[model samples]
Target: MYAVFKRELFSLLNSLMAYITIGIFLLAAGLLLWFFPDTSILDYGYAELTGFFSLAPFLFMFLIPAICMRSFAEERREGTYILLATRPLTSWQIIGAKYFACLVLVVFSLVPTLIYGYTISKLAMPAGNVDTGAIIGSYIGLLLLGAAFTAIGIFASSITKNQVIAFAVAVFLCFIMYNGFDAMAKMALLTGLQDLFMFLSVNEHYQSISRGVLDTRDAVYFLTLVFFFLLLTHFTIGGRKW
Candidate 1:
């Protein structure tokens, strides 16, 4: 797992993909937080990091899929996946390693935003009245959400050898997972099942955590989502040779 993890991390950095993705994230963060006239964080006249976190995750919805699209799809296209498949690593380990590599990249790209938070803290009128706890909580939620997206993306990539189709499927699935349940909640037919739909939706739980309310239910939902898709990825790979 460690070897596969290292190889993935190294390969991502060795290509322009990592740099390009990071650049896109930073640019989106900047544009939304600074350049936008009305909703810009700089114009909000507050020291809170709310603007950054709110915008980051939505941007991540698209960005993360692009990052993971090539994970297995590239290997399949290049016919290098067989090499890794024959290794001693189990299917779960391979998928987990890829998931970890993608998670690391997501976390690494987010490191720069700490400075944005720090800047806000220093600029606060009282010199540090920022809700540090809420900010930290939001960051944790973001990490979990990113992890969930990466797992979904890896599963999508594994299902097909074409990166383009993998990317499309990943983006569509991520969008649905992120907000599909909430949308379903509004359906007249499912009116009585609102709670069930919300419970199944990622955005509902994610929003709860983003507000600094650490609910066990929300954590369990994300963990379950990650686990289910991961198991599916394992099955997809396992059934390939069967």
Candidate 2:
């Protein structure tokens, strides 16, 4: 597993696509948080990063899919997946390595954003008037969210040989998981099931954690979601073996 993980991580780092994807995410985030009039922190007259936290998931919806689309798709497309599978590693080990590799790229994209928090802290009226707890919670929530998205993306990649299709499917699934439940709950037909729908929404749990409370329920929901998607990927590749 470690060998696979190392190889996968190095593959991502060596790929120009990975650099471009991370670059775009950071660029867009910078524009939204510091330049755009509507969402810019400069106009907010405060040290809060509410705009960043709110907009990040939307950016991630596309970024993560792009990163993971080629994980298995390219392997299958080039007929290299067979070679990979013939190795000593178990299915879970392979999937785990790829998932963590993609996740590390996600973290690489996010780590630079810590500068934003630092800048905000220094800009505050007093030296550091920002809500440290909230920021910490939001970062934690974002990491968990990224992990779940990585699992979904890996699952999407495993089922298809077409990278484009994998990307589209992953993005669609991420969007639906993130917001569709909330939208469904608002419909008249689902009115009685609003609570349940909201409970299932990734955004709901993310927002809950972003509030600095660190509820175990939200953590469990994300962990379970990650596991569920990874399990799906295992089943998918396992089925292909037969």
Colliding pairs, model 2: none
| Root mean square deviation (Cα) for candidate 2 | 1.1
Provide the lowest-lDDT 10-residue window in model 1: 187-196
Write out the backbone clash pairs for model 1.
Answer: none
Error of 2 at 231 (Å): 0.6
TM-scores, each model vs. reference: 0.96, 0.98
- Which ranges of candidate 1 are over 4 A from the true structure? none
Full-model lDDT, candidate 1: 0.86
Candidate 2 weakest lDDT stretch, 10 residues: 183-192
Best by TM-score: 2
Model 2 TM-score, all chains together: 0.98
lDDT of 2 at 145: 100
Best by lDDT: 2
